[model samples]
Target: MTTTALGIREYKRGLTDLGNGAYAWLQPDGGWGWSNAGLVVDGDESLLVDTLFDKYLTAEMLGAMQRAEPAAAEIGWLVNTHSNGDHCNGNELVTGAEIVASKACAEEMAHESPAMMAKLMAHAPEMGEVGEFFLHCFGNFAFEGIEQRPPTRTFEGAFDIRVGDKDVHLQQVGPAHTAGDVLAWVPSERLVYTGDILFIEGHPILWAGPVQNWIDACDYIEGLDPALVVPGHGPITDLRGVRAVRDYLVYIRDEARKRYDAGMPVLEAARDISLADYDSWGDAERIAVNTSVLYKEFAGDHGPNDTQALFAMMAQLHKERRG
Candidate 1:
């Protein structure tokens, strides 16, 4: 089945042609490891936006794209929006393509290998509730034995490139969702593929944030005046969706700051923040991480996130919510 929004047709899964030889590979109920990817084709060349969480998922997506459009068979360029494993872990499958990403994204990818995920999953059973929550979030995908393929080309700020006759612009608007986030724009098509910068119909996790950077990133997307916005997760959206994400960031930042001023702990602040406005969005537990990051930003802390502790908080929240 397909749903239409502001003239953009969204599919439950698989590729949806966006006219002008552009297409989006959407995964339904976009959450956790489930991400969306894109293809921009012109003549004999095609540029892929991002890949899925694992080889099997990426292979399926590639197969569908190749069957629908021959140019996908020889993807000339693969642009990873960020360092997140879900976006770049499938790089090894797009053979012969010149992989591209932000310089920070490449560096971040080097430190986060699929092996680390595999090891985490391996020990999940021994970790009790955290393990259960981790499995609930990521257990569906395979993480074992996937080779890491670093970007062959890295850039900072903004870079413009071509896919056949079409001009594709890459803008790095990050240290928001991740250390490096990118937006792929096809000017002629008036379409923008916003990596994790926009998460429609879900609470976005702020893994890296000043919060302002992410809010500005939303403004950057709006400034483009995109006719179609393909988010890193969830359905394809328009300017309305972009604004929604920006508003969420602003609201969370302000609310979290209020609690931080009261000297509330990170997890406590996270749990205390009311998500009544976003009750319809999925993965509400991510408020755990979002608040944690915001609290750090408020304190001027530049330290690395305590991943396990964050997960434990999320697990506790998730369990409490379920009960």
Candidate 2:
């Protein structure tokens, strides 16, 4: 019997063509180090939404695109939705493409080189909890020889570019997922590629947040009402997926705020608040990161995040969740 006849729709990996010269490249389970990207083709001109985690993955995605649509062989422009390595590390593979990113993303990209990740992984063996957590989250990707190539062009606020005759609109929607996040909208196709802004089946890590900005970003997506929404991670979804993530952020914000008001410690509050509906989501340990950040926001603290402490907390949380 065919796979579909067996009531199983094979979770195929690779591009899903969205009519009107658009495609979404999906990596299933959308777990750690995995991300989704897109291609917009118009005549012979093509634009890539984002690249994969490392060189090999990006090359693989590009190869698939080339086979499916030759226009992908010559990507004229590459837009990185954010600065996260998972989204931009494969940038060098595109060759001569005028890579573009929001100003904030480009700035963040400067310091978050692939070498940084490699160094961390190298030292993970000696750091106990920190090392274990680091490897757990990022050990899968190969980071060698990744000469980080940041966006050559940068834009602030909203920008639009043309792929052949079609117009692709870009909106800077961050300091939500990170310092610089963006959304790529193909108006003609009513398709939106939201970088880390939306994580469908997994928990989102707010590495940087005022929390409110992310919540607002969600509202912005709802306003667009795109017919097909492709998340930075996860399967293609619609407005409902956008709302799901928004609701989650709101839930954690409100819950953590209540605990903050009661003078509960951030760590305790993180462990205390029940994920309730979200317990089923992958990477639930991310709640530790989310709650601490929300608590910081609630207290009016705008200082740089304590990355080590947050990961330590997450490590502890991971243990608790697993135990």
Worst 10 residues of 1 by lDDT: 1-10
Please provide, for model 2 over 217-255, each residue's C-alpha lDDT reduced to its tens digit, 9 standing for 90 to 100.
Answer: 989988987878889988787788899999999888889
Q: Which candidate is the best by lDDT?
A: 1
TM-score of each: 0.97, 0.95
Clashes of 1: 0
Error of 2 at 99 (Å): 0.7
Per-prediction CA RMSD (Å): 1.9, 3.1
lDDT (10s digit) by residue, model 1, range 31-143: 89999999999999999999999999999999999998999999999999999999989999999999999998998888898999999999998999999998999999999
